[model samples]
Target: MTDATLTQTGREPRSAGALIGRRLLRWGLYALLCLFALYYLLPLFVMLTTSLKSLEEIRTGSLVALPREVTFDAWGKAWSGACTGIQCEGLRPFFWNSVMMAVPGVLLSTLIGALNGYIFAQWRFRGANLFFAFLLFGCFIPFQVVLLPMARMLGIFGLAGTIPGLIFVHTIYGLGFTTLFFRNYYVTIPHELVRAAKIDGAGFFRIFWSIFLPLSLPIAVVTIIWQFTQIWNDFLFGVSFSSAGSQPITVALNNIVNSTTGVKEYNVDMAAAIIAGLPTLFVYIVAGKYFIRGLTAGSVKG
Candidate 1:
C-alpha cells in the first residue's frame, strides 16, 4: 500500500508540472502574438494620423501625433478638387475607372479560377498534372518580365489603351494565384461528394454550378477580395497599359505625387493614398468573416 501510494504521488506531481508548463507556453505565445500585431498596425496608425494633419502641421510635427487642427479638407481635395494634370479633376475619375476595372477583372478571374480549380481537383485526365504544373510555373514569373511581350500583344490585338485591355491583363495575371487557391481548397473536399453527384448524372458544369459552387463560398470571398485589391491598387500595370484618360487611380495618384515642377502637397498625397486604399479596405472588412472561415476550413479539414 505504501509503494502504490508513492507511485500515485509521483504521477500527480508530474501531471501538475505539465499543466504549469503548458500555461507558461500559452502566455508566451500570446505575448509574442501581441507584439506582432502591434508591429503590423503601426504603419496604418501613422498613415491615419498623417492624413488628418494639415500640410504645415505634418511637416512640423512627428508622424505619430494627432493633428492639432483636424480637417476634412484634404479628403475633399482628394475626392474632387486636386490637380493631376493641367486639369484639376481630382481622384474621382480615376477612382471610377479603378472600380470599373476591378469589378469585371475580379469577377472574370475568380470565375475562371474556380472552374480551373474544380477541374484540376475533380477530374484526372492524362497530362492534367502537367498542365497544372505549367500554371504553377506561371505564378513564379515576375510581371515586369512579361510587360514588353504583353504590351506588344495588346497593341497587335487592338486592345492597347483600353479598359477591356486592362481587365484582360489583370485577369491573366490573377489566374495563377486564384487557380492555385481554389485548387488547393477543392483538394481537401471528399471525393465521395463528386462521385455521388456523378452517380446522379450531374455533368461537369451542372455539378460545378449546383454543388461545388455553393461549398466554395469561403474561397470565393478570398479570391474576390484578393483580385479586387490587386486590380484596384495596381500602378505598374495601369501606367503601362493605359493612356491618361484610361488610367486608374494609382496612375493618377502617381502623377499627382510626382510632378517634376509642381510643389508637392504631402497632405493631399496622403489623403489620396487613403482614398485609393478605401475600396480594398472596405472589401476586406465586409468579407473578413469569409476570409477567416476560408482559411480555417482549409486548415481544419487538412
Candidate 2:
C-alpha cells in the first residue's frame, strides 16, 4: 500500500462529522468568551460614562445615559486644576512622580531578581539552596510586619521621607516576589545553555548580560509588569516613605477621593483613578502576550 493510504487507514483521518462537532465546540467557546469579556468590561464602561457626567447629572443618577451637554470639564479638571486639598491643581505632578518612582523601581528590581535567579539556577554554590529557601519564605511575610524596621533602616541610610526613599522601599519590597518569579522561570530553562556559555569562557556577568538576558524577554516582561503595577498603585508605602510633595499618584488619588470636610467629586475621582492606572493598563496591554508566553514556556518545559 502507498504511504498516504497507510497513514489514512491507520488513523482514519477525522471525518466530516468530527469536523462539524469541532466547529460547534469552537463556536460555543467563542460565545462563552464574549460573555466573560462583557462582564469584565462593564465596569470600565460605567466609569467612562460617569467620568463624563457632571455632578448634577450624577446626582440625578442616570448611570447609563450620555450627558445632555457633554463636557470635557472633568477631564480638564483632572488634568489641569482640581483640588486634592488646599491645592487646586491637576494630578500632573503626582502622575509624573509615580512615573518616576515606578520606572526606576521596575528596572532595579527586575535586574536584581534576574541576577539572583541566574545565580541560583547556574552556580549551585554552597548554602545557595538555603539562601533561596529563605528568600522564598520572605515572599509570604506581610509587608506590615517589616514596616517599622524598614523605616528605621531607611532613616539610618538617610533615605526616609523622600522620592529616593520611596523608590528604595518599593525595590526592596518587590525583590522577593520578582525574584521568585524569575527564579521559577530560570529553573525551567536548560542548564546546558549556561554550561555551553561557560565552556566558551564566558564569566558570570558576561554570560548573564550577553546570553541569558536576551533569552529572558518573557520573564523580563512579566517582571516589569508585576513590579510596575505594585509600585505604581502602592498607597501605603508611598504614604509611609514619601512626604507631601514627593507623594505618588496613589496618595494623591486617595486624598482626592477621600476628604473629611469636602464633597467628593466622584467623576473626577474616577478620572484620576483611570489616569493613575493608565500606565499599568498600557504596559499590560502592550507586554501581556510576552508575559503569558514567558510563563507558558517556563512552566511546560519542565
Candidate 3:
C-alpha cells in the first residue's frame, strides 16, 4: 500500500486516543448538565406529583413518589373551589386581577419608557444625564421606601385598593427598569435615522412611530417580559396596595397557603402554587430566547 494510503487508512493511535478523550469529556459535560437540570427541576417534579396525588396518598406515599392514582381534583379545587381568606372563590378572581393589573401596567410602562428612551437617546436636553441617573437610582430604591408616599398618592387619587391603583403602582415602579432597557437599546440605534427623519419634516412622535418603533420589537419584547414578570410576581406591592377584592394572585396564594381554617391539603397548596407560577413560567418558556437576543442587541453599543 502507498504511504499516503496507509496514513489515511490507519488512524494514528494518539489521534484515536484524543478522539476517545474528547468523546468522554463531551459525555461527561452532558451528564453533568443533565444532573444539574434534574436537581433544579426537583421541586417542580415534586409539586406536579403532589398535586396529582390525593391528600391521603400525599401523606402515605413518599414526597417525590408518583401518584398511585392520578387525579386533578386538587387542580379543580385550587382553580375555583378553594378559599382565599374569607372569600370561597378560589384563585380565579385574583388570577384575573393580576392579569388586569399586569397587562395595563406592562403596556403603560413600556409605552412611556419607549418615549422616554427616545427622548434621552435622540434628543438630548439639559440635565439629561442627571435625570437619567436619577431614574437609574430609582430602580434600586427599596420597595418599602416608596410604600408610604405611593399609598398617600393612591389615596389622594381615590385609587387605593383598586385594580387600577395596583396597575398605577406597578407602572410607576417599573418605569425605571423599562426606561433603562429601552434607552440602552435605543442608544444603539443609528442617530442619523432621527436626524434624517427631522430633516424630512418628521416630528418627535412621527419619527418614533415610523422609524424607531419598527426597530424596537426586540427591546420591546425584553421590556415586556421584564415588566410582566415583575408585576405578576410582585407580592409586596400586591399585598400592600390591593384590597381583598382586588388583590393579585400572589396575595391570594399567600392566603391559601397560610389559611388556618381547614385541613392542610398539601395537594391543593401545590396546585395553587403551580397555578400562580404558571404565567411567568409559560412566558419564559415561550419568549426566553427572544429575551436573550434583545439583551445582547443593545449590549453591543452601550
lDDT of 2 by residue, 1-302 (tens): 11121112244427899866766666676677778888898888788888888878888877777766766778788876777777877788899888889899999999999999888887789999899998888878887888899899999999888888888988887888888888887777788878898899999999999987877888888889889989988988888888778889989888777752556677887787788888899999999998888767754242
Q: lDDT per residue, candidate 3, 1-302, as tens digits? A: 11122112244547877877866766676677778888899999999999999989987889988899999999999999888777778889999999999999999999999999989998999999999999999899999999999999999999999999999999988889999988988888888888888899999999999988888888999999999999999999999999878999999999988884757999999999999999999988888999989977753342
lDDT of 1 by residue, 46-151 (tens): 8777878888898889878889999888888888888887768889999999988999999999999999999899886899999999999888988899899999
Q: In lDDT terms, how accurate is model 3?
A: 0.89
lDDT of 3 at 126: 98
lDDT of 1: 0.86
Winner on lDDT (1 vs 2): 1
- Compare the candidates by lDDT and give the number of the best one: 3
Quote the lDDT for 114 in model 2.
93
